[model samples]
Target: MEVSVNQDNFSILECFSSPTRIRIIELLNERPMNIRSLSEALDIKPPIVTRHIQMLEQAGIVASELIAGKRGQQKLCSLKLEQMVLNFRSQIHNKKPSVQKYDVMIPVGMYADYEVKPSCGLASEHSMLGMCDDPRYFADPVHRDARVVWFSSGFIEYRIPNYMLYNEQASSLEVSLEICSETPCSSSHLQPSDIVFSFNGIDVAVWTFPGKIGKGTAIFTPQWWHKDIQHGVMKHIRVNEQGTFIDGVLVSNMTIDALSLCADEEIVMRISSRSDAKRCGGVTLFGSGFGNYNQDIHCTITCK
Candidate 1:
């Protein structure tokens, strides 16, 4: 589930190295079970099962919760992931690039400015931030931990450091995020929306995303996240001397120079669904640890 396992993390590696733990994962994949059930199924002692479960939980491979049972409350264990990806890039040597670069990942809920309408709300992996269609919740302190946000109209803005662009001939500025078209909370059918993106108030590009994105489970989506909408596709938007592009295809003539980025200046990224657009189905932004792409607002500047 977009797991980035660094080779240096011996503790996590050791957790997976155990055959008993591996068997535990396989058992949980079938279905969530309690300590007693797991012990019986795996023929392990209760204490050993508890110990392995604790280790798996610490390694983020499993999650447990207490639930009402006939005997009282029982701890239920489940697999937290369907797959794991090992990243070995840091272990390999590569040639350095010629350009200087800087990057930052801003969380989805950390909006510098926002104006949203009803049908707007946020949620964490475990629970909804507040009541759906309640605007006041958007301003709640808990929003800082939101993993996803959606609105029928208006904009959400983020300010990123632009010092890397100051006085330097920037080769390219890239902004990448996971997004999808929004719909009525109860609707499961497809809707279309024209989502606009801007940098420093300069319109960059408008992308049309087809709705009904949650047809299947997202690789990283938590089991508890049962909603009509669940995930979004990763989209890459770039601005350079040539033009603005969405996923590598030029979509507009708006160049990076038009943004007038300066040293120590903060680049404002605004995402909105204008009222005059052909479609205003809505827009949803997925944050780190929530969507198929385990990333937030990724911004990078390459300077020559």
Candidate 2:
């Protein structure tokens, strides 16, 4: 099935549409299940399930194995799509001078300032003072007492120190963050909305959210949250000789060298909403409180 993707795109929607295929994905998402178990749960004939399983295997969505069993060899199946993204970019290439490399992970809470309030299920994980979800969460003298949940029309800014930059050396900067939908809900059904990541003053990248928490993946979440809608993912971007990127794909034709930041310049990654913003795709900035998952969301700059 043909579909449109935003940036760093991968095709998996086709695999998700078939009822049988989706069931297979869900079952495997929890743990590897043998074909017999899946067949019973789906209530489909074993042969029919086998046919669908083959299709899924070809699509790289499922994998099967032969295990020793009394009846014979049992085939097991599992999911491969940890997270799927649809990314598109205008260009890739740079004509300007290059700089030095630097890498770092910006935690969720270490910003110049931020506003957060209690959403459902945050009180137990975080000590709450009031019954409402208000801006007061940011005012708590102690961050541990602050509500872990928050949404923003505003930006969570990160200030990159100047020491990282070096003159005329080839380098690129990468950033990682943990983010999700603002409106806490199950079965995330919100429409596509834009979330912008800016570096310096340039509009570096724009990502569209599928809505709700579980659509991608998440971190430091309470068990009470439904699993289906609690998804979140890490987007890798490069600011190198090849220009800006969300993954390996270029955000523009301009290469990293062209998007110049002087050695002494301060860099900012502003996560904010689009003008047509509809849902609360507000982000969760994870740092010291939320340990890094390594691949979830990371920013870096590298050079020879």
Candidate 3:
């Protein structure tokens, strides 16, 4: 597909300009509402709502569906933020972020740990034993890598190189990865996770997954996945120095923290899934299905 916004051109800038359109996005973010609902929510007439909806829809910012309402068919409206880039300044381009490195000599797997539940059950290429058998296995205090299916309510700790301590101009550190969980399957109900990244056991940031991540993968099929419910239900969380991004859009400003690591201590990112079966059906970790940080679900640290 067409990836990366070329420049801060008209088509891109227009995506965020209109006041009515912005209100429409804000209203839809809460829950999908039809014409009457949106009209009441935004204090606009039905004709005005329809006009703005059409404009937003044309820009691919909003979409509508005809669903059964209390009376007749209702055009349920919602936002479709598949992915977008907002450039407040023209200095940056709609391309991948730049990466630079300071020379260092260290072991490859020096600061990484992974665990899976049910012994080697998650090692299978295609199975669900690790995630479905028991929800507690996710917090089993051991096991890491998985293949078919796995769940964990604990953090996957990765100690980053303590290069930031000595580096004079290390502006920021960026950690990006593809992650999804079983707890909250659908993006529609996308809720934040309790996953925390810690520096020397000090909590740095609490992260959550974005909506509609693994939409086409079979891994999203729950034990009781029904045709009535949306299949390929999944969510993703990708954060960097700029902001926290879910799916492909920016959601929050809780970016990765730059820490001093010259003491030779490990910088860790721990992902914890709260034990809420009602929220996440439990936590199913999708390793390879997501991008896995543009490489493996591993850690990367660069210091200037």
Candidate 4:
């Protein structure tokens, strides 16, 4: 999870203020456990442990669900974030160069082009778009309303409306979205898929998603939605003169210059998994209504 180091992320930052909360995270990291188990291990009361878990949940750092325990039912808690980066740059991006920039929220369903196969389907906040595991449903007229989309193979493309003027040259581009491996609803199935990101049809970044279907519900996921794929890791794909980065880690040497974007040219971003990829597991895209983040595919462009 990437959080800007500012007042906007005060809740996330405050998560580290309490020793009890820190210890709780350390314990959950070992394995998923119930609040009763946590209370016993930490020598704390179950009520206090539940309160701590609630604070962590508010920060999107922990996930919990009600399940049948040996006695009856209990709230099972688990660590949700594998890594967290407090980015200081995001809050100060307008320091130098041109301030001419724009941000857009492109819904996951608003794909301009796509080529997908079975084990695929999409749904909005209220209901499924069409039939599950059917490629034909992807073309249904109402698909534009999809907030959660998944496919076992192939690619999906979206048009990022370029807002730069003819005299403007892009200095950097950043896109953030929630994604995970596509797999049938099974907590045991942790599918790892190599997902490739391209701009204007040119491959720029590639990363392997260590996917797992969580049993707990996402922060923004509606109650009607199934726990098939609870939530996905939020990823930040950035392109600059230096190189391409995924979550601040350089994934490719390919620089932003490779895109060669021009005026009146809408950038085409393609997310694909090669058929021969060693880990051709699949992909799932989460949007405003179905993931931890209550936002769509966010694109930001800064130009000079």
Candidate 5:
């Protein structure tokens, strides 16, 4: 899992603040070692080494397991993070003059309309909402608490409130959500699938998720979540005067003006799999209580 360095991660950062822990990470990078070996190599007391390991393990920087050894059961330690990047820019928030912004988060199961095929299912954090592949479950009242929703085909549509844009000109619009290609179970196959995003009947962008994602556990996924089924990635799709962007990188020439959005018009956001896609891996939407990023379908409109 990737995490940005910020105030929220101060505890994690503190784990790296110690020289002894830093050396331990370097030693573990070479190979997994027991507490005795680490103590000997670092020339530190065994108790001191154990204390450092506990802190590292709590911060998810290192992992330890007990195994039979020549003397007795020994704890094996290994590094979890292969790389770390520190960026100061993420902490800075820029404010613009005369800009009014409205933000809304749509829960995964609260779609205005939907049509799904087999292999579809919905689950809350605690348990499955209903029988898998049963389309009727989409309309179930209990779906409102759904944390994850997956389907083999079809689309899900949402109606975003546009009253905030009334009498104001929208300078830009952004829709961010966590999504991934769907499969029977987590597979390693990197099949190409075209996922389209449309706004107000205009095709804004068609992103191709490389494959079904599920090698490891998501950072925020609940403990009860099945290990075999993993969380999707967080993606940001933006439309502005400059053009359309996915995760801050331009992917299309479509601009906000082309949408022809009206001040009082309700915005229609639709996500669908292209019928002509070479591979139909399906789609999964993650909500606030699920996935690596604990967020729902977030929509932000910046007006001037």
Candidate 6:
């Protein structure tokens, strides 16, 4: 998560003020635990543990779900963020605004190229595109209509149209879409997927999604679609003069100028989870009909 020292973010900032809350975060980092477990570990009462978790949850620092326990339901809590990037950017208010921009709306399935493994599939709002886990189905003529696509391991590439003129100097590129980690067991807390983003084959940034947000399903998901993995967080990735940023966090030195946007007639955007990545959980892309945000891959380009 990216944050600044502002009044709106004070709730998140306050999470560090209490030693008990800090300890709760540290324990959740190790693994998801119940209130009873945390109370026993910290030598505190169950009600007190709940109060601390409530504070963390309010700040978007932690999440929990109710499940059956020995006597009654239990709240299984987990860390909502893998990490946070803090920016002391008082200078941001002094900078000039953007000049001009253009947008490209590309469907999730309109991939120019792909190399996918099993535990992969694509589907439209009305029906499944082809058999699940089969790579050949990805080439079906109807694949272009897919609204949601997922894979256990491999990369999918989309060629985003470059609308900037030849003489225009591209300033930044931003891509936003809904996505989440795909796990076989439908486990959201423990399984993390390291998703890598690339523009023109140059890896721009990588983010480790902290699994599915919760047991809740995406608001826009079709009723026919049934999967253990339900919802996803909307992610915004921007590449500008300074560097590549994910959710406003600088993740790399790859700047917009490095991409030579005008030289390439089209930008090849790729999303992948390499088997070698530290967190090898798969990836799922939500489109107009399938995820929290009812939209396809949205790419915007600003020019100087």
**Winner by lDDT:** 4
Question: Against the unseen true structure, what C-alpha lDDT does each candidate score?
Answer: 0.80, 0.54, 0.47, 0.83, 0.79, 0.82
Q: Name the lDDT of candidate 1.
A: 0.80
Deviating ranges (above 4 Å) for candidate 5 = 1-97, 184-190
Name the top TM-score candidate.
4
Cα miss at 97, model 4 (Å)? Answer: 3.1
Off by over 4 Å in 3: 1-99, 102-121, 126-145, 161-165, 183-263, 276-281, 289-295
**Candidate 5 displacement at residue 243 in angstroms:** 1.2
- Per-residue CA lDDT of candidate 3, range 109-148, in tens? 2225544332112322233324444535444433343423
Q: Give residue 257's lDDT in candidate 2 (0 to 100).
A: 66
Per-candidate TM equals 0.67, 0.53, 0.41, 0.70, 0.67, 0.67
| Per-residue error (Å), model 2, residue 31 | 11
* Per-residue lDDT of model 4, residues 1-304, tens digit only: 4588899789889989999999999998766678988999999999999999999999999988876667898888877665687888783746645468778999999998899978788889998877888889888878899998888889999999999999999877889898888643323365889999999888998889976554466766788986567678778898988899887788888887889978788999999977889998888899987766656999988888
Displacement of the residue 238 alpha carbon in candidate 1, Å: 0.5
Consecutive 10-residue window with the lowest summed lDDT within model 2: 287-296
Candidate 1's TM-score reads 0.67
Candidate 1 positional error at 57, Å? 28
Candidate 6 residue-wise lDDT, 83-144, digit = tens: 67687774456774447788888999899888887788888999888888888998888889
In candidate 5, where is summed lDDT lowest over 10 consecutive residues?
A: 183-192
Q: For model 6, name the residue pairs that clash.
A: none
- Model 4 residue 294 distance off true place after TM-score fit, in angstroms: 1.3
- Rank by lDDT, highest first: 4, 6, 1, 5, 2, 3
How high a TM-score does candidate 4 get?
Answer: 0.70
Model 1: per-residue Cα lDDT over 1-304, one tens digit each? 2244665566677888889999999888655688999999989899999999999998788888876678998988876553455665543457544577888888998887888887788888788889889888888888888888888888888898776744577777888887987743645654789999998888889899976565566655677876766677778888988999887688999998888777778889999987678998778888876766666888888787
Backbone clashes for every candidate come to 0, 40, 16, 0, 0, 0
